[model samples]
Each structure stands twice: as C-alpha cells, then as structure tokens.
Target chain A: MDIAILADAVERGERRAVARAITLVESARPEHRVQATELLETLARTGREAIRIGLSGTPGVGKSTFIESFGLMLVAQGLRVAVLAVDPSSKRTGGSILGDKTRMERLSRSPDAFIRPSPSQSHLGGVARRTREAVALCEAAGFDVVLIETVGVGQSETVVAELSDVFLLLLAPAGGDELQGVKRGIMEAADIILVNKADGDLKATAMRTCADYAGALRLLRRRPQDPDGFPKAMTVSALEISGLDRAWAEIRDLVDWRRAQGHWHARRAEQARHWFEEEVRQTLLAQLAQPKARSLMQSLSEQVADGQLTASRAAQDLFASLWPEMEQTKLPESLDATIDTP
Target chain B: MDIAILADAVERGERRAVARAITLVESARPEHRVQATELLETLARTGREAIRIGLSGTPGVGKSTFIESFGLMLVAQGLRVAVLAVDPSSKRTGGSILGDKTRMERLSRSPDAFIRPSPSQSHLGGVARRTREAVALCEAAGFDVVLIETVGVGQSETVVAELSDVFLLLLAPAGGDELQGVKRGIMEAADIILVNKADGDLKATAMRTCADYAGALRLLRRRPQDPDGFPKAMTVSALEISGLDRAWAEIRDLVDWRRAQGHWHARRAEQARHWFEEEVRQTLLAQLAQPKARSLMQSLSEQVADGQLTASRAAQDLFASLWPEMEQTKLPESLDATIDTP
Candidate 1:
C-alpha cells in the first residue's frame, strides 16, 4: 500500500520490488495511478544509464529468439539486461500470455537479466503508455540495457520507435517482390534492417534477400539527417547465435553517432510530445463514453439508422441540445464579458 | 447554383451534371456543404438502389487494371457502372494524380461506364466521407453498380469495408510461401481474393499460388452467415482480362445473396452507426484544437516536459484553465432555482 517505500526499494535495485512496482503501475485502479506516479518520479531520479533498443518486424520473424540470444550475450559480457516484450491482447479480454519468459528461458534464469512481457491494451496508446513506464522502471532497477521487442502489427512498431533510442526491423529472407509488398512507410522508419533466420538452407537466400533489401534501401530517399551514418544490411541466425556480435557492434556505433548529432535527445523530446497528444485524444474519447453522453448518442444513432434523422443533423442537434447548455453554464461572467468586449 | 436542380438532373440520368454536383459536394467551401445537403435530401427521396462494391489491395497490386477489366465486363452485361477511385495524395501540397481515368482508358471510353478518381485527403475521414457521398451521387445518376477502389493500407481496408456491399482483395503471388505470409485478418475481411496478373510467364506460378491460397482459406474460421457460401480464391489477369467473367459472376452472386439474407440493410445500419461515432470523435478533436484550449494545453505540456509537474496534475490545470467560469449578471433567483432543479 505504501508506494513510496516500494518505489524506494525499486530504486535500490531490489529486483522483486521493481517487478512489483511495475505491476502496481500497470493496475487499472485510480489509486494505482497515484502510486505509479510516485514510483516513476523516484525511479526517474536514479534510473540506469542504459541504451534502450527497439526490435520490430512481421510476426513469426523470430523476434523472441533474437532477443534471447542478444540478452544472453549481454549477460555473458557481465552486464545486466532488461527485456520488455509487448503482445496485443484480445479485445474481448484484457489479458495476454505474458510469454516472453518462456521463449527466453535461459536468459530469464540469468541473474543479470530481467524479462517482462506486458499485454498491449486494446489501443496503440495503451501499449505505448505501459511500455514507456516499464522501461523507466527497469532502468531504475539498474539494468545496463533495455530491449523492447514488438512485431509489426497494428501500430506496435510506431510505439516502439517512439520509446527506444535505436529501432531494428527484423525481416525474413523473402525476396524483393515480397519486400515491395510491405508498405514503404514501415520500412522507411527502420534504423537497421536485420534479415533473421539466416542459418542453414536460408543462408544463400538470406544473402540474396539482404542484397535485395540493400538495393531497395538505396532507392528510398535517404532518411533525413540519418544518425546511423548509412543503413546497413546484415544476416543473423538467432537460432544459432551467429553474427550477433556484429549486429550489437553496429547498434552501439549507431547510438553513439546519434547521441553526437543530438538526435537521441531530439527523438525522446518528440516522443514526449506524441505521448501528450495521444493521451489527450484517448482521454477525450473516454469522456465522450460517459453514460449520459453515450446513451443520448446511441439513441440518436438508432434514430439516424432508422431514417428518422440525417447523421449531420443528429450531430448538430446533439451539439445544440447538450454541449451548448454545458458551455453556457461553464463560462464565467468575467470571461463572457471579456468576449463581448473583444 | 441550386443543388436541388442538380439533384433533379442527376435523378434524370444526366451524367455530366451529376459529376459536376459531386465536385461541388467535395469542395472546401461553406456554400458547397449547404448545397450538398440540399442535393442529398433530394437524392434521398429517389429511393437509392445500387450495388456498391469495394476493391482494396496493396499498391502495385494491379488495382486499376482489375477495375478496368471488371467495369468493362459489367458494362457488357447491360449494367451502368460508376467507379470511384481514391488515390494517395502528397501531404505537403494535397496534390494527387487522379489517375484512374488514365489507367482505365477502355472503361473511360465505354458508353455505359463512368470513371472518377479523387485524391485521398490528409484525413482518412475525408476519404471515407467523399467516397460515400460520391457513391450516392453516382446512384442518383442512374448507375446500377458503384465500384469503390481504395489504396490498401492501415485502417483504409476497414473504411472501404464499411461503405460497400461486396469487398474484394487483390493479392500478389510472392512465392511458394506466399500463403503463409499474407495477413489472415485482411483475407477474412475479403469476400473474394483475386490473384492478379495471372498470365504470361506468371501463369504457372499463379495457379500454384491460387491453390495455396485456397488451402489457406480452408484453415480460417468460416463466417456462419455467408449466404453465398464461403469466400473463394480466383486467379485473373487484369491486363489480359482472363477469368474476368468468373470474377464478375462471383461478385454478382455474393451481392444477390447478401440482399436476400437482409445482410445489406444490416450492414448499412452498422455503417451508419460507425460513421456517427467517427464524426463525434473528430468533433471532440477539433474542439480541443480551439484556440483557448490549445493555448492552455500547450502551456501545461511545457511544464510536464520540463518535469516541473506530473502529467495528471498538468491535465487538471489545463482543464481548469480552458473552462470559462460563468457567474455572469445574475439571473433572477426564481429562474436560477428552476434551471438548477432541471
């Protein structure tokens, strides 16, 4: 119940306490939000100097396997690692498997690694909200690095891009034709492109795929002020733990380059702005769903559907009947007078 | 210009006049909206009866080519066809090619077919809005079939699905693994999936791809209420018009089956409800962007970004600052008491 004490424990690098803090923040209770805010503030003061990385791609691209290998490598280097894996929950239910632990069993057992899988609440905003908060919690727990992984479904990639310093898009070894099938916008957003499952028979095809991707990358308008110097293609076998060190080296170099260009700070600031706007949009939607407003809107909708009234007219009527009255009661005399004077 | 006069002309099967009327509705002027409402009122009284079809797929999926051959085939069937193609627009300038006429050159010259291409506006709502209104206008012009072509992308498919009776998805044959990679959500939403460009050297590959897709379709959960039975996979060469007749036959069957099962009316009713919700959401977003609220919110955001205030506290402050206090020249206590009681 005492969030301050729990937050202090989390800030002191007590692993179990940090996990507990994350759960409290993730709780939907109003009281939990108050407690979560306190925890975040405390954590913000003493969070780790971790390099946060985001990994995203189409589903079944072996993201879990890659994260597992990458996290194990970091642990082998005598560094602490944190993995925040997000999975979108079924809309009918507010829960998910939270299954990243099962995929990263070895790394999950390591003393220096922490793996947390958070359910992506129905909307993109919900997922982004918790992930950012969880990252802060992990950092506060003194993890040397944070890896956030999400498959390229819905707006998950965009959410991950906003929260992390580096974003890696894991592509399968499909050729140019298949690559062209994907929306260019998603491809353009990637900081690095890693062709996954590049071992065994997929090796030759993977190299060809990499070449095709590299060629396609050239045709794309160079990213504006790209901090990664130049985007490079790499073949990696997450299943075999091969070519990962090179991938890690490339990620570090890109981060340092971005930091030098001040892009790292700039991106975080942009992310904050995006979060602000998204919160406003979401909260406004929630407010509109309040009982009185919702019932009236639904009734009018039924009428509109039955051809009793047109849609635009119904909207205007709702505005005239409800909102105008609310506005009249809301404005102070001084404010009204100021408007008249103007 | 009198919209009622325009509507009357369109109702009388005046094609040029109907096109002009739609242009007016799509205009960004207050007077145009007033005219559009008058036109809609007149058209609504005419008892709309038209088969509205939605076609969507990723770019380079030969959408235009398919529509061209399909529309021409419908024309030959003694049906008047109207094509509404929504193309992507440049965000900076709001300029677009409106190139369907060029792509569907044969259809453009056909006496029984009408082709209109509109720029997809910056707002997805704008695209949905204009497309629906245009369909209504085309119906008023005595077009029996309205084919709406939308660029396949996030949320666009959902938008297209809401406005049409029959939905078709065009897919490319990526390779042997193509069936495995395609998103099941899109496939499920489709009433028919057409493997386009299934001729020339691509013929053998196309047949194989079709078989794979057909096999994959079996694995998906069947819609319990598909009156035309389950969704089917078909291969067509949009350029050569091969299998054009079969695709049209399938489309016609689905539309008739939907009408017989009363699915048509229910779909329209559901669409109207969705449209109503979308309008309210947009209105709330606009209200937040109003000068007073925007300024207050901006100030609060700066504080939150600087870490001088918690987000929750900043929100309360913004809400308080934006709401006008209205304790003006007092109403008579009797009236005030009466109003308060209500």
Candidate 2:
C-alpha cells in the first residue's frame, strides 16, 4: 500500500481511490490502522480545504431529503460536494437506515457530488473517528463543500457538531410541541435550525413553529463564537426546495465571518486538542481491556457492585497492578504542587 | 487517623464525627484517601438505608429555601434529613454560595438535620466522589433522607442526577419562557419538577408554569425505570411552607413504587457500574498527568495545536511509549473476539 500514490490520486479527485482510502481507515485490523495513519499523514501534507458542515435531526425529520436538496443546490453552483454520515446506531441495528445511498438517489448520481454512508459496523467513537478521517479525504479529493450528517438526537449530534465548522439542525413543523423532546444540549450545538417539510399543509404549522423556535432561542444563552451573535432559525421545504438558496447564503456568511474573526482556525485547533485527549483516553481503556487487566477488573467490579469495595479503591488497585512502579513513584514536584493546590 | 472510631461514632449519629469523616474523604492527600476508602467500606457493611434525592436548579431558583422548608417538614415527621452538595465552582470561587450554611438558616439549626456544604476546593469529579462518600456517611449516621443539591446547571447537575435515586428540578414561576435556557438533558433527567417560590403575587404565575411544565414533560420521553412512567410537575411555596408535605408524599410514593418493582436495586447497581467506569477513566487521566507522562503529553499537545501532527498519531505514539508491550502483544483471545466484533 503506497500511501503517497493513494494521496496523489485522491488529490486528483479520483472517487474510487477516495472510497478505498475511507474503507482502509474504517477497518479495525491493527495493520490497516497503522497504514491508515500513514495515509492520513500524507493527505494532511497536501493542505486540502473544504467548508465543513454538520447536519442533524430526529428520526422522520426529512434529514435525507433536506441533504439531497441542499447538496444538489451546492453542486449546481459549481461547488463539488461530499456527504458523509456518523451513525453509531448502525452498529447495533446492523447498518444505517438514515444515510442509505438510495435515500439520496439524485445526489448520489451527480458527478459533482460524492455520497458515503456511515461505515455501518463500528462503535460510536470508531464511527466518529472514521467519519473525521473521511472528511479529510473528501477535502483532499477537491470537494469544496463537505456535509457530515448524524442520525437521531444525542451524543452523535454533539460529536458531529464538534467536527464540523458549522452545525445545522433540521426539525419538522409538527416538532413545535415536541421541542422538549429534543435534547437541549443538541439544540445549543446548532448554528442554524431549519424547519424542514414546510410546504403545502404543513406550511402554516412550519411558520408558527419557526416563530416558536425563534422566541425559544432568544431566551437561551448565545455561543460566544456565533457569527450572528445567536443561532438563526428559518423555515425550509426540502420537498418544494424553497429557502435552499437563503440557507446557503447564511452558511456562507457564517463561514466567512468566522474566518475573518480568526475563530475558524482557533476552533479547528481546539478540536485537534480535544481529539488528542479523547484518543489518549480511549487507548488507555483499550489497554485496560486486555486479558490480565480484564480479569482483575471483573473481580474488582463484582466486589464494588456488592458494596464490599469502593470504586476509588478498585481503580487505585487496578492502576497499581497495571504499573507497579507508579505506586511507589510520587508525582513530580511541579505537577504535585498544582495537584495539591487544586 | 482512627477510622474505626470515626466509623463507630458516625454510626451512632454523632454530627461532629460525620463532618470529620466527610473532611477525610474530601482530602487530596493520598494517605487520607486510603483511610477514607476504609471508612466507607466499614460504613457500607452496616447496611444504611436512606432515600437519596438529587435536587438542582439554576441560580435564583431558591433551591436552599425549598430544601430548608422541605427538610423541616420531613424532620417534623420524625425523619433525620442530611443535605450534601456537589459544587465544583467552589474550587474556583473559593467557596459555594449555593450550599452555604447561612442560606438554610432554619434547617441548619434543627437538631434532626445535618447540612454539609461542598468542599471548598476540588475538581468536579473529585467533589462528586467525596459527596457520594458523604452520602454513605450520612446514611450510616442514620439519616433517612439525603438531599444532594447542585449549584446552577450543567455537568454538575447531570453528575448529581446519576448519584441519587430521584432527581427533582426546581424552577421559579416566571421560568416558563426560560425553559429553553435550561439544558434539555438536565430536564430529561428530572423525576419530578417543582415550581418553587409560588406565593402571593406569584401564585397564579406558578400554577401556569406548573401546567406548562406538565405539558412540556408530556412531550418528552420518559425513562424506562421511572416507576410512575413520567415525571410529575407541581407548584410549591417554600416561603409559605405550603407544599412541603405533599412533595414529601410524592417522593415517598415514587421511592416505594420503585423499590416494590425492583427498579431501585437495579438502578443502584447500574449507578455503581457507571461510577466504576468513571473512576477507571479518571484514574488513568490522573496517571497520565504524572511528571513523565505530563511532559510527553505537553509536547504532543503543542504539535497537535500547531497542526504539525494529527491527534490520532500523537495519541498512538504516546500509547506506544507508555506501554511498549501493547504494540506487539495481541489482545487476549476472549477480549480479542470482542474487540474484533466491535
């Protein structure tokens, strides 16, 4: 696997090569993971640029329809688009129903659009990790715009929001009273809220829902980096294709404003730091799941569950077992001082 | 230093002993942590049964007033009440204003009540861990009702929700439109919603707010373990002490219903499991903060922040350095199967 050659082909907008690269990155095999890292290093050096967007909504919110309409509009404007999804539920349900290629039939057929459903078989973190790598790949492949979609309303939405430059949440007109049904943290993460399915019979409801959301949003604390100072809510009909142009304009304005303010670069840097800490934490847990440690943890868990051992004590014992030297070695003076003070 | 004596005194309901035990648990010194764990283990063996409740609200919601009024009512019914708080802000602000002894003037002076403000200095998780231990100490001291209050809103409320049996979210009468200001996840965690400060001029507004909350809660999904199926909302006048008795009855009903249906034991087991995993993660992070690992992480973080290296690669390099054996060692067969499947 010559990563340099693959990186070169991906840079030249070779769709097949991009797909193969994504598959390699998503593989759980140890050797493949090593190679994937090498591939990413090469791709990173190419300095690919793309406007990344994260989109999310609850089930039955016309997320796929909205993405299809939104993606086609971008492609029509001569901007190559890529749609990637992060659906961890696919691991449990066997595959993602939300990001099925058939759902975006027209977008998938477009020459300027690349659609990749979530890697159907991975942990939530694994799926997020792969989706992030796929975003880099799409950028390297010369796609000017990349949209990352998440299914349902929970941590997946939060994860997508963190990885993308802008987060758009799709809601249906009937979701007005159901606003409470959506997680507040998810709503806060949205840079823009689009009331989808705002056509025909639902138009009146959608308009009312739009007003309700606007009022609701005003009461919430605004994100400091918000280009408009607050999250914007608007009505859109994915089926009728109304409001697509205005939506694009808002997204563009937000990106341009954030870039001008230097928040775009700062946010990416913060994201990098966040992923670093997350990876370190996950890697530590994986090591702990090894056989020797697993057995020890099991017994400790049983004791703790039975109220015979405290969780803190169990963790301390496991740490001692994993690294015997650490038990006797005191923290360095500099770090020790901070810990004591804290 | 004498954990046995402290444990015995705590079991005998000595208020001073209970306070001293909590202080020992909250200590950052490694030696004190060991003794605190020992004390908890002994206390656990005594089979202390108490109905643990977590109460949270944003600042200005009158959490202390409600708790004071509510606590005195329970004490009048021959119940011993203990109020413990988890406030990480205290570490930054130097002390908590939410759980200050002065805030609950009447309750603090009661012979049957014990009030412990959050430790003035500690991390969020550190405070939560200590507070959990304090809850056990309170139970050992024969308190039948333990109230764990969290200041303001955010992760602290979620942490408190996880540690308690029932979570009650208090709000002011004028908080109807401000509903969107509250985090959605926190609202979902509530087992009961109490509209406090409902008196005189605010009485009608509180009733309307209570109805609004009830309607909003109906739109949200209920927790599967909730004995009553959905959270109930009601208005209360803590200042006038009007709804204290009814609130206690509702709490008692929920607890009794859950215990009868076996959800109480199951929920506790799940909470224990969650804390076990949390402790393991935190302990690993602490170990990584040690002098040797700290220097390596700092350098890697700088590279990651500068965009010279991807977070994934940096984490891999760190993990390889920390556990060289993991690089070559295949996971144990049992764990390998699970890892491969995931």
Return the top candidate by DockQ: 2
> How much of the real interface does each model capture, measured as fnat?
0.12, 0.31
Tens-place lDDT per residue, model 2, A1-342, is 777777788888888788888877777667777877888888887787799999988779998899999999999999999998887766433244343778998999898999888764655256567787899899889999999999853478878988999989899886556777667777788888899988999999999988888888888887778855458899999999999999999998999988999999999988878878777766666666677888998888887877777787787788888766554222222112111100
Show the colliding residue pairs in model 2: A184-B184
Candidate 1 on B190-260: residue-level lDDT in tens? 88889998988988888888888887777778784475346888999988989889888888788778778
Could you tell me the lDDT of residue A153 within candidate 1?
70
lDDT score for candidate 1 against the true structure: 0.72
Angstrom error of the Cα, residue B288, model 2: value is 3.7
- The lDDT, on a scale of 0 to 1, for candidate 2 is 0.80
TM-score of 1: 0.71
Q: Which candidate is the best by TM-score?
A: 2
List-wise, what DockQ does each model earn?
0.10, 0.28
Question: Can you write out model 2's per-residue Cα lDDT over B163-272, one digit (the tens) per residue?
Answer: 99999999988755676776777888998999987899999989999899898889987677776545989889889999878888888899988898888988887788
